[model samples]
Target: MTDVTLSVPQLHEWELMRAGAYGRALRYELPGDDPHRPSLLVRDTAPGSTLTLLDTEATPIARVRVDGSRTEPEGTWVGGVVEPLREPATPTFPELRPVETGELVAQATLLLGRRHGRLDGTVIVVDTGDAHAVSQTVRGLRHDQVDLRLLPEPAAAHLEGAARTELLVHLASVVFASTVHVIRGEAPAPGDGLVVLFTGLSGSGKSTVARQLTRRLRAETSQRVTLLDGDQVRSMLSSGLGFSRADRELNVRRIGWVASQIAAHGGIAICAPIAPYDSMRQEVRAMAERVGRFILVHVATPLEVCEARDRKGMYAKARAGEIKEFTGISDPYEEPADADIVIGRDDADAETITDRVYRLVMGGPEPDYAI
Candidate 1:
């Protein structure tokens, strides 16, 4: 197969936002680094066809890359800019309300808001601006059957066979696609506040930090705080699981799945897991984002310290002959290359680390106490 080359639009990290056709908002972000790797524009320009059209006088398109290894420097990739709006940013995000081709484009507008919280900047159209732009967009989208090329949301034709069936199903299900449902009777969805994830080696004080932070969230704000600790889960939730890589992943997935349920119900999920792998972390983050929110907090802990506090002597057992595939000892731990907030990454004590996670999570207003 010949390699195809495409010049895609540039994407920036901090200065990006997306507006759905249903008036819902979508924030453009990568799982990790490269501030400029998630662009929303591409040029498959053709005669009487324009690929880049401005919906309004101003629109914003951004670029970002997935989270990478913690030890490596942050960087972005350059791929063709056309990607299917995977699962849709929201329900009305892709199909556009009333479900039609042009509707998505008309309602989908990228705003290049003024730099640094300003909204007076020039807007570059997101996906062909209108009908003319859509017609022009058909150029690069040229494909045979089984084509996987990405197109402007508005250029998408839900009129196809499969799409049509899905549309009918969706019609039968009267729930709005872009609707935001608060979690439980308390927890706030990403639409409510920031959802931060806590990660570390076991005994690295994840539960400690989660406990202290929850205390603050309860005292300071009315936000309903919840704890999904490892031991608690290992017993009730993941009882049948063991200490294998696959088991660990399954456990983490269950944790994320439950946490997503919590965040979905509008409550915070202060999770404490040895979430020893980057892929697992990314998977959880996607789960959180797919709904509305997810924040990653790496409780950087030293192996020596964790081993010292082995309280349960699991580390000693692992060092002996009783343990297999222990995280940070036998099994490889893919340290988070890029995380939203880092705590105790550099040998900070439990008390200090607890303070940092608390500040990062709830923003420091509680009675600063040590673990």
Candidate 2:
């Protein structure tokens, strides 16, 4: 039998398999659109072949047998595993803890009944700002627990007045397993800290808009405003990083972490990066929202428009094969479906773009910009 190897990059995939969501079948998607040039696992492996699944660290996670079955929409292969793999000795991810759903529900119900005399009309909100936290909390939950709302930390933090106070008291009481007193005072101003992240192509004017917005915030607002522009950040924060997919992801993550720290300390951070991957953008949003609000601004200037406005001749270099993995030329930019604001090509002028962003940051209604 032929032996094949596959790499699993995400933890959730393994978790799904562990939860028996995939049953005995394994489905793998081929990398590109070309069906003729499939990977070795898809093209060479036939029935009775052995498939070895490896994690990112090159550790063997599971073994499967090829079933020679094809899935829908083309370029997907299916195999069957005789039994589930054993758990790793050292947890692949130490940061994630297995959420005890039953215990959590029991504690929450007991606390609510003790405090309010009943569970009716009571809602338990789980802070799901982290992706791993969300996955862990969600996978173990039963369908009957309708009162539990898994919201992001920022949304849950937006609770005000009596609702917010009740949540805090309940959390404290549950943690301590005893009565706890809460000293209420004036809440902190909502506009104190946040991250405004701008994403688009390299020449999509996001950096310009970010710079202008930075100037506006510094001139008008009392809070500290830090601008983490792409070129400047690459020069300083990510000096030795290359332009490969892994390096680009690491660079964006570094920017996200620093921006999160700034937001945590009651400082606004304006960031402009060509964050092409949706996963990376979601990661940054999650990191920022754990500490403060996060606004994703998608500068939706068309690719041709951006290429035309390129002043540094980078686009030309990319088209001439001088640059590899350049976004919009050799790489892909995944448009965000969760953008809080979309700046279209019509909002061309710097002042108009900056004003739109400024209004959003200063607690104004989000403008109806088409995505």
Top-lDDT structure, candidate number? 2
List lDDT for all candidates, in order. 0.49, 0.61
RMSD of model 2, in Å? 11.8
On the 0 to 100 scale, the lDDT of residue 33 in model 2 is: 43
Compared with the true structure, what per-residue lDDT tens digits does model 2 show for residues 59-98? Answer: 6666666555553322235445434465533432333222
Model 2 TM: 0.55
Superposed on all Cα atoms, model 1 deviates from the true structure by an RMSD in Å of 16.4
lDDT by residue for model 1 (53-102), tens: 22211232222222221121212222222222222122212332232222
Q: State each candidate's clash count.
A: 33, 0
- Candidate 2: which stretches are off by over 4 Å? 1-191
lDDT of model 2 at residue 99? 29
